[model samples]
Target: MRCDTLLLSAALASVATAGRSLQHVGRKADDSLAAMYNNVARNYASFSGHHDEPLHKRSQHQFLSNKTSSFAVNGTGIPDVDFDVGESYAGNLPITSDPKDPNQLFFWFFPSTNPDASKEIVIWLNGGPGCSSLEGLSQENGPFIWQYGTFLPVKNTWSWNKLSNIVYIEQPVGTGFAVGEPTATSEEDVAQQFLGFWKNFVDTFSLYDYKVYITGESYAGMYCPYIASAMIDENDPKYFNVSGMLMYDPVIGPNDIQGPIPTVAFVDYWTGLFPFNDSFVEDIHARDAKCGYTDYMNKYLSFPPAGPQPFILPGQDSDGVTSDECANIFNDVIYAAILVNPCFDIYQVATTCPLLWDVLGFPGTISYLPEGAEIYFDRADVKKAINAPSNVTWASCSDISVFVNDTDSSLVPSIHALPHVIDTTKNVIIAHGALDMVLLANGTILTIQNMTWGGKMGFQSPPVEPLYVPFHDDPVEGSIAGSGVMGTFHTERGLTYAGVALSGHMVPQYAPGVAYRQLEFLLGRIDSLDSVVPFTTDKNFTEQASEADLGEGNAPQGYASNWTAPASDTTTVKTSPAAKGIELSLASLAGVLLAVFYLA
Candidate 1:
């Protein structure tokens, strides 16, 4: 139940596999895996082992059973469904053919409000590596935001499904209402399963003509790329026309190393919450000087100090230091900063004081949400209406054990995979909330600046340009009479890097209007990328509003407001008991690995 306890369990499990290389860790597939592989080889022989074979061909549970219904939809619990009866589908689609270890993935599909079926099919995923897309559906960008206080759903005016058919899929094997053992231990496996799910999804819905755009926030950043790559590798344009991908506040880099450094610096520099003492600052500088971290912020990929060089912390010595020790120093500073901040919501800096600190330290579920979503979704009536499995309990995030044995936690294959996706896809857009500390905009910018795509290593022009989105108040919903600067965007060769202002990890939940316009641009619904001009406004004339009037409150709770400076200058850096346990676990894992190496 405790975050540290779960992390420790995961660490121990990971360390147990340290002796074997990833390639050889599970090379000899189990019976079920072998059967799945053989199925692919037999049916899709031409594409077998080509990475382009439809994952469904490899799945043992290739047939899909329909569990859809048109029962009385719960108005109080359902948001945006004004009509009593409408087209909606929810059920489990088998991802693998293995009968013994069937991986049935859960999905909720909402048909586009447009009846013509002319719109593209947009799939939204939430990244916890273990989290559910249902969170995105109910709390963030879905048609309804669950209001637990009244046990009612509020209409999300800017739902992505407004102009596109949106499907929220609970992926991998054990996430959300999906049923199976938590068998997937890597992102590659996840992609394979997702492709299989997609094949079933299209077949079941008969949506072969619809273009696909994959989008998600957080860990989905890592997921979208691999999924896109699979689609590209499959080379089936008729079945998989992946036009674009859009991600907000995604985890693009590997977690254990260079990824955490830029985030720590950005938070400390921007929030001023963790005011390091002069000695600490000087110590960091000395270490940086000695460790040759001259371009630490911009140049992070050239890290791990090449060879025999010792790893150094900013304010600490390099003597007898291991790579893990240096990584801890970077991670600790960020962790300590969160502990010191009154509102520990790392995704949104302006949160006054967060209530759900229990969610922290869990991968991908760090952001806060309304209280009653879990309860509401679990209700038998609600589950039945959506055709969810009666036996399975729905959760916003998956259990830590689902990922404890994961081999890809420290891997950044997604980053390397993006260029290939970009090369094949029509367009790719990466957006970040400017104020998010969890995955800072600065880090994202630096990563993009260092990336190679479209025959160029990086953008030739400046990486910052003003991005504008039409502003509209709730009173005047449809029309955009005025414009406001959303953030900055940098573009080159069908790839765009955007910074969304007054937002956090969940872009749609915070700045829905801007997010909607951004989606329009990515979908090619809008003509120009720089400007968004709304078509019409409410008949009741409204005057242009000031910045304060349009900011913060528009965002969900725990996501709006200015950072309230702590009253006292004296800052106390205290590590949580959970954090201490995590530290001890890491140390123990490292010690064991060292002993193994020496013994070998």
Candidate 2:
């Protein structure tokens, strides 16, 4: 079924302008913000866990017989139900690891739409340190997406569950439907809690043999590395085979600290916005010069609060600097510039804002799906059907106090755990949306550039290479129509860095097709990371393209100007197929026209 063109157009336009038009102001008094940081630090320092206990002894589980009673009639008696064509299981499972902090983590699991006993199992989390992973399910790559203003779901043709069993868990104690006093203050605590949950989930489901892949976006960037590391360190391969991890628009620390400032500057110059004045830009450059490195901003931002001082600016003599200046520049100058440009979205520049500023102070704009899903999930009948707690309110994004009090340890660097992950896992994919300004692609690239894996410090050769996705329209027989350059990929020593074009922080929602193809490549369904030549209906083209990594199919016929190849010596330019003179169907034409008109 086609989407509502008018709704789509409006969404595109709004999302495009959402982050633009902020009013920048001068610096403010440091005491208030400084106090906030001090409180945060105190919260961080106050956190204590059962660190003395052995890792294996920390996890405890209790199976609720009542919770399984509502499951759809599958022989296994799991909370399984048919949502359209696929099977789903939704409810809460208890983690009694720390009896003092008993928590029930909510999970929504969907079996692969295409049944395969040996298909991989993917566990997905969304990073807020408090955000619900249900957003990833209903809004991003889940089988059914919530239709705004309607109490119905639309089938997402490109759902990730097509070839993998996907599980979305609302983690930490206080997130989503999970109930308990929030106690996890560090990623280590978060990982320990997850390990407890995983043991119960896998044992109950009898899924010990399935190959598992840990995945998430944003803050999950931190969570994934730590979780993957813990799984590797604790679980035996015979019982829990952790294949890999995939991070989308992640907040990998250190590199991500002051990364936004330089990213904003580069984007402004590239897009001809010149948002920063000469004085501010000169100050930034002068600071960089004093630090003797271009990435000094990130270094400064990465520093933790030592006593009262949170950060020390370059060339400063005393450690009396407050974090207020850094916060002001990020909010007032950098973010404000993006807010002023209706054409630029901080998450995805090509799209308009789909979110409105909340009356409550949420750092980013809240999405409509979470609100709609909350309504749908909270319905009495739906709750009965899913066997969920009827009284608990379903929240898309959790309360900020959860972060302030229970997740302050997120400030601790999680990137330090990636090396251990790379050494153990089959592969590690660090992907970012090219248009994402929140966690910029350049920052991810920098992080990867500085990483060491397989006894090597970095890639010995040039890393950037054009990544192509098949044109959905008029795919050639047996071969794909290389329609456009969707993104770029660089792989070295089991570590891969990818830039997804035409996407935002929520990559699966913005560019589902490319995102799906990227996952296929990561899963080894496709031969190479750069080119995607799916087996097409046309026998001749498939045979030809199958022979070489560079397929024999003609370049894309109709969509040439959509994606441009990056300027690099290693980049390979492919010729688009000759135009077949096939006009788009009226419905397709109308949708295209609406998008163009609204975007223009």
Candidate 3:
């Protein structure tokens, strides 16, 4: 696979700010990173996932499932449902402010609690690079949501708030309620601002000495590591006590464009799921050999283009589905039948479905929940109790600027250096869901194998899954069933890098129990006197991480420096020489056709 660190670096340039000193980690302003921050301030409703459709589309089952929507009872099997989560706790945080711009101070506060009375705290950031953690706190992973025009409470199975004092901070100046004009010009600038936010967060919350773990997914990958490094770099034993980190399906590096990963792995991933011709994938692999050993993606092996899959456009049902169709499918079929909204509710797109019109702004309509679902952030009951505003607007989509800005700045340097950084750490865990189309797991593996950690050996080898568990629950089988794969990482030195279980890009969102439990195991929060858990093939064995193993005494220093740039035709190396020739021919033919058809 081709890995181009520079391309990733170029993308992050526009929004980057200069890096700040770690000594003032908590004091800087402008840490909030998002495209929505500087160039524009988008309406809230526009931020939620919606297409340009006038009304949302709906599936037959979605309509039927909506018919079964309930506000009276919690769900089919849930008992003693107490829906009363409110803002019993409140706090404020400040960011760097220009004396000239009085109203431009950055930073916002989120309620945190240590349900277990522990000194450990975990900060949760939902990655959009520009998306709001407040939304993540209330709507997606937190404990409540604003409902029916009021604050409401919901429960969470994997609430990090319960185990550790969880803090959700709006970062990168322009993100969430943290308001500031954007002037950042480098990734280092963004890193400095983030460090400033963390320092301020610690000072304001009086948790400067707390054992903290920074965690997130997507673009947050770009933010978390740099911030963590800065925190540790300051060498403030109290403020810099970053024990370890957990990144769930993060976009940490620029492997997508810089590495051969996209070229080699994408073919297998798409073919496995879509109706692409089987020969197409084989042909592509034959053409580009870097797509090494993709047997794990056998499920996606299909024939030529499965007539382009349906596209969900806004305002129209050309595909006969609504704006919220994808989400509805996720909510209704995957989790309990908590309808998030009619397929039309998300995008407000015009649609032929009468239900879209009926449900649009229907009175007494509070937040829609997927069945068998519970609110994590601002629950309906909590909103009512607090008299909070219920009708907050959600953006239909994230500002493209945020992703472009964050990735452009953060991914480049990091991707180039990640292998080295990972090598020295003794633990580097990367996992992906086989079925996830957006961030294909096979692509992750391909990227990893091609990477040379610490410039030494390439991070190669198949993941050894010691245990396998069915992820999703299917009524037909009366048990959880699905291709929920788990990968256990083992270092060449015999240390357990990490174990990743079956989950989508947002692993924590899909199975918090697994995610949190894994974190605890990683951080040695469990009762394990042993400093390390040796890998075992026995099915019943359970392993855990020990603090001693992760402490300063055991942690390694600089990684080896044996990295080598791969050849330009990296994708062609994985196949036999004969296969490679055929692929070149096909690609050449395709290029000629496109040139004649489009350019001519």
Best by lDDT: 1
Ranking by TM-score: 1, 2, 3
Please identify model 3 stretches exceeding 4 Å from their true place. 1-82, 86-92, 97-117, 138-140, 144-153, 255-272, 277-407, 410-429, 446-461, 467-488, 491-502, 527-600
lDDT of 2: 0.52
Please give the distance, in angstroms, between residue 245's alpha carbon in candidate 1 and its true position after superposition: 0.7
Which is better, 1 or 3, measured by lDDT? Answer: 1
Name the better of 1 and 2 by lDDT.
1
Candidate 3: worst-modelled 10 consecutive residues by lDDT: 591-600
Deviating ranges (above 4 Å) for candidate 1: 1-86, 97-101, 115-119, 147-151, 256-258, 273-294, 298-325, 354-374, 409-411, 475-483, 535-600
Residue 250 error, candidate 3, Å: 1.8
Per-residue lDDT value at 143 in model 1: 65
TM-score, prediction 3? 0.51
Q: What TM-score would each prediction reach against the true structure?
A: 0.68, 0.67, 0.51
